[model samples]
Target chain A: MSYLTLSITLIFVIIPLILSKTFKLGLERDTIIAAVRSIIQLLAVGYVLQFVFNAENAVYIVLMLLLMIGAATQNARKKGASIKGITWKLIVTFLFIEILTQSILLGLDITPPTAQYVIPISGMVIGNSMVLGILFLNRFTAEMETRQNQTELILSLGGTPKQAVHTQLITSIKASTIPTIESQKTIGLVQLPGMMSGQIIAGADPVQAVLFQLLILFLLLTTAVTTSIMLGYLSYPTLFNQRMQFLRESLIRE
Target chain B: MTKAAIEFKDVDYTANGIHILKRITGFFPKGKITTLVGPSGAGKSSLFKLCNGLQTANSGQIYINNKLIEQYAPTVLRRTVGIALQEATMINGSVEKNLALPLTLKGEKLHKELAIELLKVVGLKESYMSRNTQELSGGQRQKLSIARTLVNKPQVLLLDEITSYLTVYPSRTSKN
Candidate 1:
């Protein structure tokens, strides 16, 4: 889109601002700030992508991917700040998802090892996996808190840490993945995903875009399950100590 | 007195920065009921947790059957020292499933007859086995919790306000 077209998108922002003012919702400031931040952030990423695409160095590609993973980890860690070392756990989860998804993509020759393909695809993979990680952590911690007594009872009844948390882990894993699973069940009928829409808008064949979107949906399903189980195993141990005692302090929300 | 089933050696427990049990040193004797009498918030529950390796002591050691509490695998230790909480939180299922949890964790078969016998021990009728736990009354739920704990055959059962839910003393109703 041209700068003129982008500038016209400001009118969309005005709708929220006008609504905030009309209803005295007091969200005008936040709306303005959010719009400005999105503009600056996207512009910054756009320039960086241009540079990376021009360079096409393997080192630069790896570095850019690391940067994305780091940012996503930091963002997702907020949801699980109650757990110690959660940021590192998220880093490992995102890194694993990125490596797994990209390796499969490049290994199978499904997508070319080009900056244009690799970077955007990695971004989507890392982004969705980060969200899945957050959902898993959130549900896991909440389950641990609400079911603290149950967990302890299990422990009291000769259960190992794995047994105590077995139910919660399964519940959280299912909870985190349900959204992705349900959304994919009605992907085309309910919403044409952004990737497909973007590809079609850029003049790609609709059928090809649909095929690519399907690939992404499958990758997302893998990510949703893998990230949840990995994060679940990694973080559950943190809820207890070496003595196999449930650390009640970890359940207290800060 | 017979050897203590569980011993607390200068145990100190803190929760939320408040000292709950300060330098507690005591023992609950084997094959005997040991009552820990205290007003509400008096660390009675905290003391029970320390015994079962559910909560680690802040600055002391606990022993179960003459072994350091930490030395035993928590899974093994918990099998010997069971605790039933005040709320008697039931799993989302029939009474049979809830009773089978401890055995399921141990990879043992769910003994239906044993569950019925334990139900009778906890003043619960055998018919309650197929009933959903959610449908039970508060007192019945507490009895179910006690029966579930007994399924594991814990050597030292820690009851936390368990009798508060029952109309009569649990001893009068319990056949065990």
Candidate 2:
């Protein structure tokens, strides 16, 4: 990337942080902490991945992916108040999407499924899907807790559990997918995404890079949509009862 | 009174091996406001959950309309027992979208007029019908929530500290 492009990307990132502080959404300390964390984590992962990709060891690649999944599972559980057995919900959703997509790619001979193919692709897939899953689960659970009455009213009024929580379920699902939809709409026109840029930097054909980027984006869209839907359905029942009321215990922190 | 909307008989509920509710028998009559009042940690909320079929009694039976609650379908029970809690959350969508949730899932029409009517009934103007729910104040959100529940005219409404967000007058109005 050119200095100009790098400068623009930094500006884009920093501008949001500055504006958020100025708007009083959070203190400057938060921005500082977030910035530091992002920087260090990315740098460390970059070096570690550099080694992994060159080594091309499948076992190492699988281990690194599990580490990511474990971290994400812990993060989700913490956010959702440490309800027993909830971590499995997140892990199942994350791993299902991750393994299913990677398997498809390997079966089709799309990528070699080696370290180079596995690490970056799995990282992007797991990382992005984890984020969407967290957002969906958090928002959906919170929504159920807050709107317990309305949801129950729906059930009492002859609506099914699916019918009652339908609004929140849909909102969570959409929240996970909207960014992907927006990026797809503006691909190439607004900006060339990181994957395509990386391929281009590595001396691949521009056309081929775009094609590959499109495939990755498609995979991301599918994974995100599927993960959010499954997670939403799975976690929502934990929030309500057979008789259609929100469980008070479920709503409260454990 | 008509047939009891819910009956708790010899209900015992324990969570993590801690008995929250112990052998409580009661009848919640149909169509009248009955508040479950008690001191903190007294299992008022636990009993409420039993009524709504959210929790099962470890050693007893809960019946809704003379049928075993455990035997009832969750979706069917939810449809029969409307419930709300203190935390009124707004989903990430327009007001119209949130209001249309029940109808939409049933594949019914949007009923824009009815949505606007409910918004007005809840003391909100038609303008809020298009606004994002996240932007509303706590009181307004609570009112919107009540309106959402009343949209389908539920048989029973389980309210858990729902009045916490409202002023004295609105709180009074909420019960009426």
Candidate 3:
């Protein structure tokens, strides 16, 4: 690796420690712990990828992706304790996003099933899916818990549940996409995103890197919006009953 | 004869197979404060929820404003039957934001003066309009909660142990 790459990695490793001390961010222990865990986890995955990459087995690749989807779904469940059956809902969304993106890349002959392409693309898709899952699940659970009455009250007042929660639904989608929006706005000017910078470091032309970055941004937007709206709508029926009353048991965390 | 503001007929509600409100039947008049007094777990809160359409009866019907409440939309019902529980929370925003939330939810424009006027009605100072609700005193927050309910000018307001959180004097002051 070039000295430049090494230097960038060093900065990523050091910045958190400096931030924790300078600002008394109060997250020093967790930051250190997470950094260590990430290093160990990434290294372990790297070793496993050596075998998977050589085999070039689509089944293995898909199995790995399924494992990731399962983990993401579990995290979502734990995060939103009252959200039952979200695992399958999330898996379906992940599968849809993944297959669609893979087809685009493969159809365009951009990158083959090699580890260099599939792994990174899958990583991006999985990472974004995880974030969207957390945001979508958190928004739904919190809104459902606190606003259940207002929701039912609106229904009683002659508004459908969809109409009653229209604002809330919009708010949830906005909350999920705001980070992506900010990143898109600040891309290039404020900070270098990983994919574009990685392409450049891999000796891709700057213009090519820019095009790839644009594609990634577009994909992220589509996935985030779709996953957020889907999760919100799917989770609604879980919170109410046939008579339209808020299900007390569904709202309670076991 | 005008229909009562609220009528619950033979309401039986069981959550998790445990009866919360059993065979409840009552009529609350409009333009008046009808207190539901009972010992703890006497289904007082459940009854309030049923009347507001927050909960449905297992085997009965509710009428609000002379119409079957179930026929009304959720948003409309909520707007008419304003509710404030003991754990009333002020959302993360200015006092004006919290007060104007109901109207805003109904797709109305912000009415800054309405928040201040309602705050004053609940014995809060006019200056509290700009303050963050988190910084308010307990009674101040309670008053603000009541003020929030009034944004829609709800025909019926549901209070669950609202005064229970206030200090000795403000409770008396607010009721009067």
Candidate 4:
């Protein structure tokens, strides 16, 4: 698309801003700022990705991947800041998902080992897993807070830390992954995911794009489950001390 | 005098910069019933938590059966000193499953007879075993909580205002 056509997309933002002002929603400023920020960010990323794709060097690709993981970790940690060492746990979980998914794709030759193919796929995987991590941590912490008495009762009855948080862990894992599962179930009926649409817009065969989208959807399911379960286990330990006592302060609202 | 079942020596516990219990020293003797009487917010529940491994004292030490509470592994310590909270949070299952939990954690066979007997001790009937705990009344749940704790046969039972939920206290409830 030409710059003029892209600028036309600003009409969408203008419509929202006007609607907000007319309705007295008080969201006009935020709406405008979000639109401007997205434009700048996406344009900047587009240029950087173009350079990295041109370089096609392993080091550049690795650096870009690391940058994505770092940003994703920082964003995801906001929901879980109550638990100690949450930042590192998020970093490890995101890194694990990125590496595991990319390695599987490259190792099995499911996708070619090229920046053009790897970068976008890695972005989707990392971004989705980050959201999944945030969902799991939020639900898990909420469960821990609400069920503090039950957890203490379990601990006081000779249960291990694993046993004490087992129910919450399972509940959080299921809760986080439900969106992914439900979205996948309704993929074709309700929405055409970005990857498939992007591929079709770029003149790829409809059948080929559908197959690739299927691959991504399945990989997302795996990443969602793996990230939630791993992060759940990792975060639960931080809620307690070495003395096996629940750190009540950790549950306090800051 | 018999050795104290549980002892707190200069125990201090603080939460959110507030001192809940400070410089507390006390003992509940073995083979004897000890009652802690105080107004609300007296930290009676906190003291029970310290007796087991649920909450550690901020300073000083707690002992169970004359051994430093911290010295025992949490699992062993908790098994020796079980606590029944006032709320009686029931597991999402039948009463039998809740009673069988302690045995399940210990990897022992669930004793059907003992479970029924414990229920009876806590003023519950044998028929309540298969009933879903969610369907139970508040008083029934409290009894089930006590019965569940007794299933582990903890030498030092910490009852944290558990009887407040019951309509009538059973004479056999404290025999252990």
Report the number of the highest-DockQ candidate. Answer: 4
In candidate 4, list every pair of residues with a backbone clash. Answer: none
TM-score of each: 0.94, 0.61, 0.64, 0.95
**Candidates arranged by TM-score, highest first:** 4, 1, 3, 2
Give each model's whole-structure lDDT.
Answer: 0.87, 0.75, 0.75, 0.87
What's the distance in Å from true for residue A77, model 3? 6.7
Candidate 1 vs candidate 3: the lDDT winner is 1
Quality class of the docking in candidate 3, CAPRI style: incorrect
**Where does model 1 exceed 4 Å of error?**
B173-175
| Residue-wise C-alpha lDDT for candidate 4, range A41-78, written one tens digit per residue | 99999999999999989899999999999999888877
Interface RMSD of each: 1.3, 4.6, 4.4, 1.1
lDDT per residue as tens, model 1, A3-98: 999999899999999999999999999999999999999999999999999998988899999999999988898765478888888898999889
lDDT of 3 at A187: 84
Model 2 alpha-carbon drift over 4 Å, by segment: A1-43, A79-84, A242-244, B1-176
Query: Candidate 3, residues A58-151: lDDT per residue as tens digits?
Result: 8888777877777777776677556667777777878887888888888898767676678767778767977887887777667766776556
DockQ of each: 0.78, 0.28, 0.22, 0.81
Candidate 2 RMSD computed on C-alpha atoms after optimal superposition onto the true structure: 8.7
lDDT of 2 by residue, B1-176 (tens): 33888887898999877889988887888777787778878887677666666556788888787788777676556556665645665556888876776566567766778888777776778989889998887888778777776665667777766666767535445665
Clash count list over all predictions:
1, 14, 17, 0
